[model samples]
Target: MIDALSPLLILLAVALPLALALAAALPAFRARALDLLPFAPLPSLAAALLATEGARVGVPELLFGVRLELRGEGRLFLGFASFLWCLAGLYARSEMRGTQRPTLFAVSWCLALAGNLGVFLAGDVVTFYTAFACLTFAAYPAIVSSGTEAAYRAGRVYMVFSVAGETALLAALMLAASGAVSLSIGGVSASIASLPQRDVVHLLLLVGFGIKAGLVPLHLWLPLAHPAAPPAASAVLSGAMVKAGLFGLMRFMPGDGALGDAWPLLLLALGLAGCFYGIAMGLTQTKPKTILAYSTVSQMSLMVALLSAGLGEGAAGAAFGALSLYALHHGLAKGALFMGAGLAPLARPGARIGFLALLALPALSVAGLPLTGGALAKLAGKMPFSGAAETLVTLSAAGTTLVMLRFLAAAGSQAGSGSERLPAARLAPMIAATLAAVALPWWLFPALSGQDLGYVLRPDNLWSAAWPVALAAAGFLVWRRAGFPAPAVPPGDILVPLTAALERLRKPWAAIHYPPFPKRRSAQLRARGMKVLLASERGLLSWSLAGPLVLAVVLFAALYRP
Candidate 1:
């Protein structure tokens, strides 16, 4: 099946971007290439849809056996992420219309798009690594394109973390591959749980992918990086690129609960911590993008927790299903939010209300409002948890609601100077993305779960989803009535201490130059002996003294140690 669709997958996974890149090389095409960026991802979207049945494309000689495969999970990931890329590209052409260095931006977009799509389709370790590398490195330029000081700092932090992540992933992959018969993702994943160094490999892979997933302690780059990038870039960064880390986790780790490793529990703890941590930190942020960034942290944490719990319970199939649905919902919703952040400010007052309505659809959905994509996602992911764990999962929706409300407040504050409505380029994509977020789940749920829409629409499920959002709304009202000011936690909250510690160490280290060892009498005597030894060394090299020395060494070796 994979072999049969290999050609089309190759076109979507590799050839489309290569062609765009080639076209970008010509000056005639380069001038207007930004306009064409939105379309570059269309092929990928098509392939993702067509290849839902599954496909594999590989060439043994290409970059250590480059191979691309699309199964159900990969297909869903590809379809959703590719959809985001396409919409973000549409948003970008207008968002970045008069921006500097358009050509550089266009090239980066194309490269990153290809890499992002390739990751979902990747079948082998080498192929996945290549795709991950492309996505990671190619995104650097996009992040720093603003040329702001903050953008530069964000890019630096992002690259530092990215390099560290790649290094860890490479090590983990090498270890996993060493014990595997085949280097494909499935083969490596199957072998990982049984490796002698499985724990170490697991840790490395977790930290490696966790950094990309924006898990706490390793998530400092996200708030800074997301806000620093253009809205379109932020959309992909939050919506699609970050999902790569989650994909890595699913691909490399054992999800079947059969591994019997303690790592899954640890992952669950990290995920739970991140879920709350992101909410606490996000509320303190004043920027819409930063709020969204932290929101991503919170959201992905739930995913990490879900996947980890699934692994612990040995329900790999169920875990992947939940992750797929959740990711699809998030990719579209978050992408729409980021784009709407940009569009909201540009929209006229009369039209802005409607735009805000559009924005709220996804925002509320993200908070698990009943009948929305988020509710479907939340409900679908509810399978792994029961008892208290399940309650905690449902209540996390309140935190999401708070974050969404905050995002709206922040975005609304940036309304443009003119009373003009949103431009078609921006408005069209935002509307499309939001609608997709709302409607896609209904269509996809049946296919993915073999369950009807009625499951999510059930009264109990709707109630489970609604109360958290309602609680959050009430909490917001109380907080507003009390007039409590939001604390101003800076973006990259934990990074401040780390930076200060580095700065504090800088002068102390610079002040202390190592002095030459004290020239005591013993030292002078040792130096004299060293000079005599050096004088003998020259004669030894001349083969005069060397013959006796060589013979002495041979005799010593023959005598051996007592």
Candidate 2:
């Protein structure tokens, strides 16, 4: 009986942090809870390290009656994400030391981390969904923590997409579950495997996860959200949070069976578009963190290409490995870049020079210059991309070069006098994360794939990496000579038009189901509308809607249900 309690271990991993975060709500423990928040993710770190291959943990009676399991795939993601969170916690501690409402940040941070690690380790479909939702909602606090106008605007945009995406995901999950009481993702996928309507299920799932993956049109939140958060939060959001979408796609999407013929191709096209789309927008951005955010948008799309390939070729395991490596590489590198960008405002010139030299490693690595972690990830992904995917990948590299060059140019705009230096709290995380990002890929790539590293560094490959960068560099030089002008659009292009359209649409959503509401032409009409609205809202009116009458109705309804 004790041996069967695998789910409890996974449960504890997420629960410990969450409980501590909730403890902050208690006035007596707020301070301690804030302090404990920095260490709350430690258990996840441990499980990732300790869980044996194929070791399984499951519990059915946990949250929302969802069965949760922890397996090897979950362990890999849990390990890296938890480790990233642990470091982020340290960084956050240093940043929030003297700030008011430390618990506010701590609560959100822990919630995000808990949800992140939980989803990766969760065995059942509903369990993963619960954790994924927790992860999405928790990010809001960090997004709004600064309370700046920019932060507020970004947070609002972020909230809209996050909520919409989650709602879509919930609906799609229910569709896939098809009333099955059993909710393990694998089981649900197996059930859906032979279903005739797999096409709709796949499309809904794709859109739901694609939103989180930061695919074009849906990716508007990423640029707004990542830049709005503090440096520590930015690192985790850019590095790890986005990967949850990739993980979800991997876990939920059926890779072994044939779906409708066109689905994989559609996915591939979307992923490729995301890559170039991000680079294009990133190049025009002035904010360094915002630029990196676009880079993330680009990278996520690149991963989706691998996912598309895996789905089409029935090489799902390879896709998993490729996606893992891509996420791991980008998470560390981008995290380091954002952290570094945050710190540059205070760094002394000499320190800045040193940091720039270090920063350049990952920046260029991301451009796929030979021998970098990014290159390793790119190489790992090469197998999946074919024909048109290959072309997009190549062109995306060039565009990435253009965008990265713009970032480097803009990053230097933050200047400090000779005597000034960024706080060690900030500088240390950036430096440490950068070094680890560079080193880990070199170490792990060889182990993951026994392919000759020497060949990767050979003359032809190095030149292949260099030409795109050179073209981009040449374009930068020409632009510099011609006077580099900021692009007319904001950091998020097309988003302005999108926001305007949304504004026009908001009135309809405000009118309840649209096309059905009677016009408010008179007091009587207005009053009736108000009453209907009140009735509708009564269904969703209060967080504490557990009145006796409500409870009786709920019980009666449950008993009366077919």
Candidate 3:
């Protein structure tokens, strides 16, 4: 009887945000909206905790055949995401409290969270895609919070990629619905064995989810988008939001099939490439948040590889559940770390130790270092690897260590940022989140996967975790000793060349927009002056007159020549 109530709770969770968004116009709630946005996820957080450990959350039909459902894995993801939303809410209160229009941001945050958690709870692909699409674009305000040129650019790029990726997912969903399991992710996953268009569907789903997961080439937006937001927002964006992409892949794509083998291999290749690529670029970053963003790219790739391995072995159950936990820990720890980075400038001498301690949790967790949930997350991933995947995992661990160590070094060197006096609302949530990151995995492991907690604390495991950090630290020392400077290349290396090429293309397009089109700065001024003319009376008259004049001239010349 209680089990049946799970879905109702999930629906109510989503309703909280939807209701708040609708009620924003209420004069009484307008000012209170900011206070309500974070707690909007409370229902979801409760559902996540209640339903995560194989809770048989029943599906309730919505529309003709669609189901708004919450399964175990779904509940698990919802739990983490909702928790992040709650934490971010507190952070926003502290950080963005003084902003001009808090309601707008509050509304965006609640709506985005609703959509984010909804995607996971969605039983069918359409519902999932709808929720996902909501999150993908609705998050724009958070990305563009400061409204700087850089912020706008980051938000724009994020919006573009998000649209492209969602379109791909939607198309794939339609195809899956056209003949297969009627669009339910569970249905598709079940019937994927008999599906004729399996390979095509797999690849499309991979690409669609890959874009959000920050897979190479498609990942151009992470470093830009993550650091562009406020500290708490950045925490959730990096930690929880990106996981939606990966979660979509895990749910939508067939985890194991002869035809799907190629897709997993493709995922493996991309994950490995992303792992190394993130580390390479991260080493050059001067900003702690930017470096952490790059580290997310690398670390997330490692988690992707874990899912690929599960798919390779046909352990969909483990694959889905483990990735949920992985996302859970990474989100909390990463959020904490980023939030902690925001505090570097204002921490007192007495508080500095506490702050570094806060920052260290995620850094170690991300590196898969022992005594952290991140280490457990990696240990669980080993279930699917034996030979070559082992080597790949090791390299990934090494890469994560390098990137995180670099991030710490960079963050420590500054000891100061633009902001001062960390707010309690922001500080409290991160601390709570970090504590949760430490304990949740251990608590949930027994019920979710039945893995012994003892394994997480073993000496050999600690040594295994330590070696990667030791080696990376040694390398950092050598590089520093040799006077090797961190690369002076700007954050988002590809943005420069991409921007230059875009300017070149815009020239031709602008030419088409206006006669003689726009060429440069001076031409731009003339176009602004004549924009009215381009669409004005004089412009239409001139075109009409020119057409007849040319026609008359042509007719006269032909007759005279004859």
User: What value does the lDDT take at residue 77 in candidate 3?
Assistant: 78
TM-score of 2: 0.86
Per-candidate Cα lDDT values, in order, are: 0.85, 0.76, 0.76
TM-score of 3: 0.85
Top candidate by lDDT: 1
With candidate 3 superimposed using the best TM-score fit, by how many Å does residue 541's alpha carbon deviate from the native?
37
Clashing pairs in 2: 6-57, 7-57, 7-58, 69-123, 346-422
lDDT of 1 at 24: 73
By lDDT, the better pick of 1 and 3 is: 1
Model 3 residue-pair collision total: 1
lDDT of 3: 0.76
**What is the per-residue lDDT of model 3 for residues 311-407, given as tens digits with 9 covering 90 to 100?**
7555767766676777788888888888887777777655666667667777877787777777777777665667887766766777788788777
- For candidate 2, the lDDT comes to 0.76
> lDDT tens string, model 1, 420-483?
7678988888888899998998887766554688787788888989889999999988997898
| lDDT of model 1 at position 131 | 87
TM-score of each: 0.89, 0.86, 0.85
Model 3 residue 315 distance off true place after TM-score fit, in angstroms:
2.7
| Best candidate (score: TM-score) | 1
